[model samples]
Target: MLAVLVSLLPLVRVLPGCHCQSTNATAAITATTVTSVVSGSLTSKVGGYAVFDCPVPLEYVTRRSRPLVIRWTKNGHTVFTLSGGSLTTDERYEGRTSIVEPPEFSDAIATSINVSSLRESDTGDYECFATHKNRDLQLTASSQRPPLPSSQPLSHQSSTASTLSAVGTDIVDAGVRIKLDVQGGDIMSIPPINQTRLEHESVHFSCVKEDLESTVQWYKDGVPLDDLPILNGRFNVSLEGSLDIYDAGLNDNGFYLCRIMSAKGTFSAGAFLNVQYKAKIVYSPAEVFLAFGKPGTLDCHFHSNPPLTKIRWEKDGFLFDTYNVPGVYHKLNGSLYFNRVGKEHSGKYTCTPFNDLGTEGPSTPMDLIVQHPPKLIVVPKVLYFRKLGDNITMPCEAENVDNKSPAIVWQKADGKSLFDPRVTVAGGNLTLTGVKSEDRGVYRCVASNIAATISAETELIVEESLFHQKNFGLHINSTKKNIVAYWKRPYSFCTVWSRDTSLKLSNWNATATSSDGKAILWNLNASKEYEIMVSCREEISGESLFSKSILIHPKVAESDQLSLQELNKSTGPVTDSFDIRVERSGGNYNVSWTFTDNSRKDQADVERYQVKWYDAFDGKELGTASTEANKRHIGR
Candidate 1:
């Protein structure tokens, strides 16, 4: 267990992102070979088998038939296999496991084993202990990744080796590849998942008939459970289709079937069982690419039969903490978390899991890559000023690319391309050589990369410079259901800019115009954010330019009526409360007051209300505190 924790430290750094709620891409199928302890686990469904292939060649340790004496152990070296001479086996794994028979070599027999009739308790690290030339040798068969053969030769080995308990041997690191052959089941009567329990714990499996009065039968590994001598007749031998082993032992683990004969038909459904000591890591993501700047959880899922006692997390190698780094920490739910992701958060990550029922073993490690989104380092101004025939440029810059520069595009507010000869768009900037009245429109720069996309808006007003500041302003706001836009009579025209927020490109930047003074732009697209700007002009053509610019934004109403501010006007202070007096007490210059708080009367002991101590000269607060009604006077 200590060896696993030491190997997993120094995995990852810092990150800033959401809790991995949203995803912009599908998982790219990663074809990785089985190499490390993390990727060498052999996974097989319940009641199946898994194979472990050692990296040592058949010729490495072959000395006829009795070349090397070998044993297999799990969870800190509790012997699962004691194959010294007469093929001895642990009680928990009896009759279901065996040394591979082939190659006609003695060392080949000890190098590999087939773990068959698997139950949930079999989910853990498995290591081999052997006696070669009187020198103790150890090789581990463990991984958490999908089984794939290693590209390296048989002599290939990983430099990193994990330490097992009761060390008295020379450890040899080897990769193990595991393949799981899964078979589906019917949904008629869902059977319980495979069970793993300690000695004397209860075990149950039942498959009832469509007709309660029908006959039923129970079988364990094709044999009647009642004949199990290890149970010592502690099990119920009735033919009622319910099998219970409350006082279970290691020999009781095997395939259990509850067969029922009903009017519909005769069918069988059941679960498997195995004896285990404590808990073990069952599942977790081998890799995760969380969005940068968004909060995310590094998943490290695990399971235990007797209920887990605790879990410890380690990242990029030291114990994970929020001390030096503020937002990163370990969670009790078997996952590391971050309030946000930063660039320094790129690296490998791992989890050290173990089960401490009567023994302990280290867990597999995982590596995940987090992708970061691009950022707009420089954005265009919200409004731009220009004169006739004068050149104009809107510089838009972006940074934080995912290994490459972000793609930049320039377009009008109405989703039309600005590819005219007068308009030159290079990268994120737009340059207009000769400004005209027609160019007086809203434009934006869009920058995007694999991680995310961002944009900024800027409006060019060439015709506005021809007109003087009229000193008049227009106010705008929205109600719950309507976009009420109105102005005085001299306002010759009003323009409404809207876009369907539901990603419908056909309705992008839809506009509405009215000429009869009061432009009540109502019944808008329910999903639109209307940018209603009203401009006035004396005449439609012949140098009678439109009034400067009256841009107003319609906001979602937070209350009865949402009053928007007119950016063109200067106003005084807006307040809804009154000031108080600070009394001069007998030349000591103390202040006191008695104020009543009629509101929130239901909440007692809450009043000394708005009393404050002010300097009276500078009109700034000097001291402040609430006075309790129980005591009226305060001593100096």
Candidate 2:
């Protein structure tokens, strides 16, 4: 038994104060020895394996009486163990671990623990211990329990024996520390950073990772920004991996990168820094007044860093569009143009500038006033007739008239101003009361304003009121041999004239001068149409007023017979109670009639009657008049 235990003791270098002893006097134990085959750090990619070797010298294996116990531990935890040539692994490293000692190296006592599929958690300090036991040398009875001094007390003897036993157990246990770093796994990945700051504003950017033990460095535009000479004092990086800028300007804008490096790997992320600026209006249009039918333009000039994306125009409080007015359109440069301006085009205009960032600055409004001439909508009548001591009225109207009430004026054709007490003008109307002959002339109405002046003319005619009688009693008696005519005198002295209308010849003998307004015909024609006219004159002034002409016919009795020459001539029936005569003046003709009942009892009563006139040369009927009275006057 002693020899077998002796052979199992591993050869190892012992510490100076460590000693091994056995309880049996014949059994002797040798000191254990530990050796390392691999040491220091070892790095490998994730999902790979690493081997840690613990080698013992061949001389120690040959001298061993029993197989050594080999153990592998990581960070103070058991990983694998081998005893009596049998391998046992801890539950933590079950399938992915092995302790191998090749058959070729059996005598050498070299062994290794293979850690398969290394992970980040496997990175730590590792150690291996080769332990063996033997029972040969004996501990002297005096060494186990030292004799107490002759004068010392015996009560502390139990404590001394327990101390000796602990010292012996420690001397036999031995181990070696081996360090191998198994690194290579996921590293910290910084997220992208985007920051914006206004001009002259401070900004900060951070690249931090809480899950990794790493240090971060920043770069700008693919260049190191930490020690750049250009950013001497304006920029800095904080201990927590933050880059801060003080009073940033346009020059600080660029792409930035944050790089992180650790024992595992290296990773990088990028960020874009932007310096913003507010939009400003450099120039704006001024107030303008465009004439009618003239073109106009309004411009709004602006400046911005990111450039303007859109621009809009407004009129009054409404948005401006192409349909707002004809010939109006917008330009890309924030300007509005009008091909032709009118009253509807007049308004307040404003331009709004916008960008991707936002709208900035105040807009200036402009006023547009369109000037146009006054247009006449209504005018007075062209001709007006009025009797003496009558009133006359003329009206004129205009659109877009001046603010002043009296923008219209009335004047005569002779350039005589007619604005007087007799003529009142109000609301574009002119009225004249108690009109006389002097007021008979062409008058003009003139409208004037700041834009333009226009005028219209009208004529008025006035006549004296001398004739007052409604009817003239004219009667004619005719027979087969002679004809006579008389009338109730409207004036003191008058003259009578007779004519044959069919022959267009005057009857000189039938014409007479009458003081009592009576006349007789000496020569007469039967079954012939004759017209008689009477004129009444003032003896002093020779002013004359004519009565209506009378149409008469002299006829023979029903039993009368005519010669063959007279029978061949055509004649019309004689009318006894009704007479009609027409006299033409200007474009119109005046017709008058007088009637007296002379029919027999059997004749029908006149329910209605119509007077007709005919053209003398063509014998064509011109017009007809209907009346129920005995006398009528018609003007056509």
Candidate 3:
């Protein structure tokens, strides 16, 4: 009798410290053989492949020359077999089935089976059985459906992998090839994008592209811009991007875009094209006129970002040789220069300037008025004064014509310009202050502008003006041997006494108070005489004239001369009357006398009277004694 038993076994994967149970059963029976069988199921689909192997039995025995055979069956039909480590194809699958590795039996080893290039018809459940002496194990496999190919273009979208099931296994699958669209997104960068510019300067623009692999074509306003002088085969395409113009032109001024096509894509971009042109000077140098050989300054300025081109000088429409050529620093603002400026240097000049745009600037015409000789005149022509030591000044004036302030030279009759130290010239006028006797001369002022060939002269007579000098006179006095002297000056002017003989007065007391141009002095002595000389003078002209000198003496009293009859006053006609008196002081005689009716007496009767007295030496009256009484009085 044979007994069949089925049991389910739980598999434990080496869990920690779990005890395993083993069971053994022994039965005694009449000589009967039992074979152990193990089986599993496998599945697969079209375009899919899988493998299955029989599990090793729990109980086994060693046998000699025992061969394990793997049998492949389709729907319970034997279709192929694997043995001796070699796989053999059956008639049903002669050209369809292949095994990468043939199945072989071993004591305790499992085998692997490989199927390749499966088809839809190959989808099915397959049973694989391993047969050994008295033992057989079967395993079944089922093939599911193969994955479908994706229809979307990979070039347009990102590539993705799809999960596919074949014989109960998942696979990463892909379908179709992808490529980039050559004309998809073509773009060109605008050239000359930055417009950094300066007035009167030129600039350039170009076409640039980021992608250089495409055929580049430049266009302007939707029209192909080909064969341009700046564009050529050598400049067709550049890594820096595209064609560049050496210099931008006004005709080339437009929006330009470059078109390019490549396997990657097509691209185009607008290029901002700029043609730089130099700015022109709207006006030229202005003309200036000046007197020939005279000092003059011309002013000209230009209103431009770059300033003026070159400062040029001209004479009478002809370029001045002095500044005809450009100087090292001549470029820029306008120029100012005086030609030889002689009488011939006067004329109109034109200033011309050219701009970067090759445009000529407007000409500036300047008219020059040259005055060669200066005009001179005098404010007060005639001057006068009274004293030799008086202050005076001579002033000369020039004409106000020509609106030019000229230098005035005050020339004296001696050709010497007014005493250098005493003369001053300012604002076309010459002045001489503190006029002295020597300052009396013909003074003339000359104003000149040689360029204008014109001059004027004015004559000045610095005469001593009456009110100017007013020295009045010198008062002199003396007491005993001491003499005191003081002078009076004119109020119209201060009197100065100069050490220089040429200077009538050197010391000038300007502050000396005067009552009408006259200096006064007080406390003069009457004893000693003085010799004083003075002259009257004018203030502004410093002129002195009319000098006078006089001597002064003390007044004598009648008692200075004495006679007895003058004392008696009774003597006929009082011929020589004397007032005599005796004084004890100094033991000297004091006498007073005067002629009686001196004018009424006849010339013959006006006799020379002899004064006689008892001389201390003689003690007797001389023959000229009038009487004995007079003699006695004298003796007393």
Candidate 4:
């Protein structure tokens, strides 16, 4: 039993181990003793695969058959093959990777393939083998991964860490120590050398350090910024050891540094600045062109730090208003709105954005122009004739307004306002309701806005009723001669007359002369009733007037009658006789004669005679003429 127990103990310990191997015998037998082999020992950081320089040729052995078939692989994948002294590279490595030498090279007897830039995956075992008759003859070698080359050193690597003892001191030297033996020990990054920034723009600085959690102190020039009263709203400091300049300007631009209150030591970055201010304009002159009595709006945007506490706008050196503008006097989130604008708004405007920091941004100025007042336009200037009691409407139009407030007002020539409370002025237009004859004169429209006011006037002609004449008259007379007569108008100086079938007579004349007096009509006819017309103009509206017609038939008589008689001596016993007779025929007269002699007293004594007559109308007579007594010798 003692022997069996001792044997069982040995058996138990070795039995478990041997049993485990027996179960995995096939895997163990197939395992490879692929120890790492190195060639081309000098390593480089770039290449697609590991390379090796064979010390000897694979076909050096005397055995012939396949001579020598060498297989090259990386990470268990075949990369190339060598048959005798010939080499065949894999397709993947055709162009991107290549061998420096052919397989048969005598020099070094070997060469390596150069892949492109190396990758981490390229790190793996690389094996080469010699085969005879397609069977492995011997394992040539394996190349272990080469060590990667180190990075290039920084250009200023030799220089020590730079430092600045003063909080705001700039132009610091390298390899300096910070000691509080004298006073405050703080540092700030310097502004970049000769750096230029637009005026009213922002500038930022960061105090970089390996220990980002360390506290950093910032300074401008040589003063401690945290102690200065000039730290209005224009400057700011960040918790991440950074400084911000909301609006950096020429005065704000200087040496700056950031010093860390590190447990070890202080470090800093030095910078210099050259702040530049560009010329700017606050308003757009082209879009703000305004007409006389018209309104305008000008834009003003400027650079400001901490944003502008206030933006004061001015016109022609006069106070305009303070504004909160969006993307103009302030950032895009600002606010500014304009009310009614006018001609007074035209001119140069100044926009200044500032805070207590002594005004850091540009003050822009823009120009404005006032244009001509709007013209009044009326539609259907001559409306249809309205009856005495009819109602009408007249619209006055005026446009191009910079401001649409307060509206427009309408007024008539008669001093009475039109439309009154019922009138409405919208969009530069005036509407009139219940217009009457008195509204027929010239009407004036006035446009007013915050900036300016303007007015336009137009005439509204109104026709009178046909049956509304003030006076009507007629005259008749008896005559012995043709009468020349016309109606002597009364002293009613403001009147007109017409004489035609249509009430709208082309011959109608306003007998009331202008300031320069002259007869409105000249010629007249007699015996027949002469038609005359008159009209009375409205006192307020020259367009409103009444018309009247009248007929005048004046009496005229023949004052003097002349007779002509002639005798011939040679023809004795011959006598010529003429008779002068005056009779009334519609206001004119006619004369006739007959001559008788011993030759033919029975023939009724026919002869020729000459007669003349004078008019009693104006005391004038016509010329004399001869005619046969049979024609009655009619004359006047």
- Compared with the true structure, all predictions reach lDDT values of 0.48, 0.56, 0.39, 0.41
lDDT over C-alpha atoms for residue 431 of model 1:
90
Question: What order do candidates take by TM-score, descending?
Answer: 1, 4, 3, 2
Q: Which candidate comes out best when scored by TM-score?
A: 1
lDDT of 4 at 618: 42
Identify the runs in model 2 with alpha carbons over 4 angstroms from their true place. 1-344, 349-379, 387-390, 396-408, 434-438, 446-456, 464-617, 621-636
lDDT per residue as tens, model 4, 1-636: 000000000000000001111110111111121111122111211111222332122344323443655566765678767665556876645433434343242322223333432222333445555555656542222112111122211111112211101111111111111111101113322211224476767876544344556777767776677865555677777665667777775567676655566765664443444566532334343334444432234555554433445655666787664443222232332223234344445567666655545454435456665555444454324223344454545555556554443346766556775546556665545554554555455566676554456666555434454444444332223243432223334333433343443334443433223111112222222323445544334444444334344555544323322211123322222213222233335434444433433444433433544455554444357666656643343433
lDDT per residue for candidate 1 within 303-413, as digits (tens), equals 554555656565677555445677887676656777887766666665555556732343455655667766888888655657789899899988855567888888787
Give the per-residue Cα lDDT of candidate 3 at 463.
35
The 10-residue segment of model 2 with minimum total lDDT is 154-163
- Candidate 1 residue runs with Cα over 4 Å from true position: 1-296, 303-306, 316-327, 339-346, 355-373, 377-397, 400-402, 406-453, 457-636
> Could you give candidate 3's per-residue lDDT for residues 358-391 as a string of tens digits?
4234356676656544555555343333355544
Candidate 3 TM-score to native? 0.23
Residue-by-residue lDDT tens digits, candidate 2, 1-636: 121112112121112112233222222222221111121323332223444444333333332535666677888988778667667887655555555444543444435455543445566766667665632221111113221111111111111111011111112224544444433335432243456688789887655543446777778887888656666688876665667888876678887776767765565555567887666577655666565676767677776657777777788978887766679887777677889877888888777777777667546877776766566678986556578898988999777633433278788876667867898988788899999877766778888764457888876655453223224476677655445667887678665656787875443222555666565453335467787656565454334444566788656555554542353243222234344444444555555544435433212455556666544334357777777764455455
Q: Assess every candidate by TM-score.
A: 0.28, 0.22, 0.23, 0.23
lDDT of 4 at 346: 51
Looking at model 2, residue 226 earns an lDDT score of 64
